[model samples]
Target: MPQPEDDPGSAPRAAGATNAGATPPDPATVEKLRSTIGSLSTATLKQLDADLPWYRGLRPDERSALGMVAQKGIASFVNWYQKPVSPEWVLSDVFGTAPTELTRSISLQKALQLIRVVVQVVEDHVPFLAPAADQAPLREAVLRYSREVAFAAADVYARAAETRGSWDTRLEALVVDAILRGESSDALRSRIAAVGWKSQARITVMVGSAPSEPNVGFLNELRRVTGRLAEDVLVGIQGERLILVLGGVRDPAKAYPRISELFGDGAVVFGPEAESLVAASSSAQAAFAGLTAARAWPGAPRPVSSEDLWPERVMSGDDTARRSLVRTIYRPLLAASNGLEQTLSAYLTLGHSLEATSRSLFVHANTVRYRLRRVCDVTGWDPLIPREAYVLQTALVVGRLSAPPAPPVAANGAPGTGNGRAARAGSIDKAPPVPLGRPSAL
Candidate 1:
């Protein structure tokens, strides 16, 4: 049994003494050794089948292919022993029998294990085949040849790994592009599946300025950090912008600060969360729009939500932004109660003054306060908070703009007719009239 140090196919070592400075074996002895190489290859394969779990698990065809490699390795060693001074040609002659695809099927470590088994089998047979005087030198040659083979195997696998990495990177970029383009084709899904994207849901897209120079190291570090956070990220760099589609984020706002520094110096905006990657284009569109509109808000947070720039986005003719404001803020408040919407409008119109809004609407101050609270409950925006008040006011304006054009009023207060019947219109008509200096249900 080989000890750990004598593990024949560990890393390659510097070439030592050629045949331990002994005389080369005679031609007769070399022929005898060559005749036994076939048996040696067969025995090595049998030993691998018995001792190596991975070898035993290979399909019959794969095993046959690997057996050919072992036979070629044995024959190559015998050829190397004949000319011990030149071992450079031995690697190609040994590995040339196996196709490039074999490297993909078997890992480098397993290939090294195969080399070790063959070397051990050849070493064990050296004494039986070589003349007594040449046995030690023959064993020494086997060890040296094994070392060279190990190095050759490492080179093959390294090249294979590099190629695979490059291919995967390109495929990942394609998947991100498909997501951004909102193309949910079967081919796109297959491409994403090929890249092994683990997170299917809770996806968010973030857009920002890319660094001035290529920074592979920074991108790698960002990947490492997101991986540690159990997030899946697909990144793309287009001109000066960087886009990242992140998945499995429970709270995008909380995740932003950690990744903000990884972005280039500029406004970084996170889009709304989507249920899954298939629907992430909606999020990506919003983020891309926000990136274009972020300049409008000079005081925008470093990692602002795409929805936070709704006013700017709406102004920029983003129908999604206008519809989002109407759906999330205006519709809900409008459906809850006319009084809630009217009081909210009055408060904002009165500069968020409860007393002033009450006086203007003919309601007591307490009714205005109650309506304001209801507005907060309905819209998740408080009239008391300056920032939220601004959002609410913007939503009101956007909602009115997005609403259908009102029917023309006639002299009689009827829409498109000139009758004298009163018509309910605007906020004041929605609120019940309050007696002078008396509170009313808002």
Candidate 2:
């Protein structure tokens, strides 16, 4: 018997070689076994349906493929009994008889179970196939062949798993790339399903530097670790960057602190939660932007939220940060009444000094403190802390930038706001008065 190696198709050949020494049954017995191949195959299929609920649940084509495997195994056994040739032929002749889809659909354990059923059926029929004198050697040959096919089945599954892992890695990369690029399509959705992402509850994107010399095992180890942290996670390592799409994390810090330790020494940033993978593109963009912008905050935490790095992200010219700041702080303050926007603006601009802001706004210091408290209440950002104040200041700038151009001065000296349809009833039809120095042509 040839020694089994780690390479594909080697172990199976060794198994075939092991079967080489099994004494072939008598001609009458071999002929009977070969002739009854059809009946034995039928019995195996019937036993499969009766004994294995999972087999009955299989798609019709998959069940049919497994039946073919049984038929081929029996046929190969009879042929090997007569010929007893080299190792190369057995894998192709026995296990290879089943299609790739069969292996993919059914696990190695189930395949072994199928082998057991086939061996059992043949054993039950041995009495009819051969007389008592011929039965022992025939049973021994069947046992040897079963051992060989079992090893072959294991080898095929190992190879299939290796191939699948490689394919899933590439597919994950494609899905992550599509997310970062903001490409959503039927194809991308299908690819996500193929990659087996299950974090349907909440999706988040994390970006950081990649560890050195990350290999297949390195990624596999990460998968093992993250399998517990988040419900579903897709990991992609690009050049020096590592990106992860985490699903089902209500609070990333609680669920993901362990993951941050695994990242390369640098800032790790998590984007806001997204509703779905397609929507996660927005989160991915934000996380990438924060990672690029994280360097500006030397004192930033090991793992910081993208929202927390808005100041640096704004400096990096990230539109997401700009919009986020304007929405979260600028718009909220504007919407809240009682001079919250004005007081907060004064508080930040005047260097977080309550008295100075009160003096500038001609309000009581107590009132300034009250308005700052209200600012926190309305915007969920405190203007009291220097860092929070700086964020508020940036939000003010972004909000101002995002504001519409000063409504063009109207002829009647009122701000010409809104389209004509919503303007003063006659504004659209009224012609402008000619300039004082110019000729007023009719």
Candidate 3:
């Protein structure tokens, strides 16, 4: 039903309201609206300006406008003392003052409340640009208040952005350092998961061209693919390698093709499914071992995992076979110099006789004794026993195969002096390579 507009002659309702015919605003709703304005965080309020009406956005002229408005309100209110004026005039008289008077020290909460009131006054009746009568005190008060509120809002958002940026930078540095040191894949998976990463099952490692500047969106796409392909998957970087760990895969082999396509010509090794991250860590270790093998022996069409080479590792562990290999490889080195060879052969053959080999090498009894002792110390083997001799022989052959290539022989027909090889060949009677994890210097 239509309602009649209020007659001009009728008394008006209270201020901060629409026309009398308009539905009366609920007190609760008004309070809620006011609270929302008062509670707006500086960051959130700044966001509103992106799409808010022109009058709502921050403006350089806002301070002057506030000062003028406040001066006018206070002046009009005072002037009304001489003659009758509208209720708005009375409101200005009650509240308005110079903008300069509203100290910049006001809190955001207080500023927000003041701005809402200013907006309300403009909406109710007056244009913001209305000329000030003699209300200089009111204009100054409102101008100062508006300036303080705007400054508070901006200051809050700037502080929040700075805090967030610092956090993000620290996290990036931690991740990069961990990768280079070869951190376990499962740990990385757990971290990424807490930050909304969905991939926690199947794993593959990926290395980016510019890892320091990660494209989060692209990595996120990779995470999404793993989720669809496996139950839980995670991707991370380790040094130059990108590691992906897969968990709870229903058919690991079936998913391999898709991962291969995504990580072409990259170190994309996969791990076995496991019940938990600890199990996954073990599986990742196996994958890493396999990856090490693949790198050493390339030309395999597909990526391999550590589980694939368990048989070889086991077979290579046979004690008898290893002993035989040691004997075959080092017999020649022992046979090279007659004086040295015969002494070594006799020392091993006759149970390391300082007395027997002394007579055998035709040297002074003391000299034979001294050479045999030196041989034991040099090869890390007891010349009097077979076991230590065999162990040392095997290690020498293995060291030849695995150690870095001997530094090139020098132009003077001498091995380079600074490198380990030059040092070793310089004294053939010196110590051989020690066993793994035990320093040769010892």
User: Candidate 3: deviation at residue 2, Å?
Assistant: 51
lDDT of each: 0.81, 0.82, 0.46
Worst 10 residues of 1 by lDDT: 1-10
Worst window of 10 by summed lDDT in candidate 2: 1-10
Q: Name the best candidate (by TM-score).
A: 1
TM-score to true structure, per model: 0.86, 0.82, 0.32
Per-residue lDDT of candidate 2, residues 99-178 (tens digit): 47767779888999989999999889989999999888778777877877787787778878888878887999999999
Clashing pairs in 1: 412-419
Order the candidates by lDDT, highest first. 2, 1, 3
lDDT of 3 at 23: 37
| Cand. 3 Cα-lDDT | 0.46
TM-score leaderboard ranking: 1, 2, 3
Q: What lDDT score goes with residue 101 in model 2?
A: 74
Model 3 poorest 10 in a row by lDDT: 122-131
Q: What does candidate 3 score in Cα RMSD to the true structure?
A: 22.6
Give the alpha carbon lDDT tens digit for every residue of 212-263 in model 1.
Answer: 8857797888789777654688888888988888889766556787777778
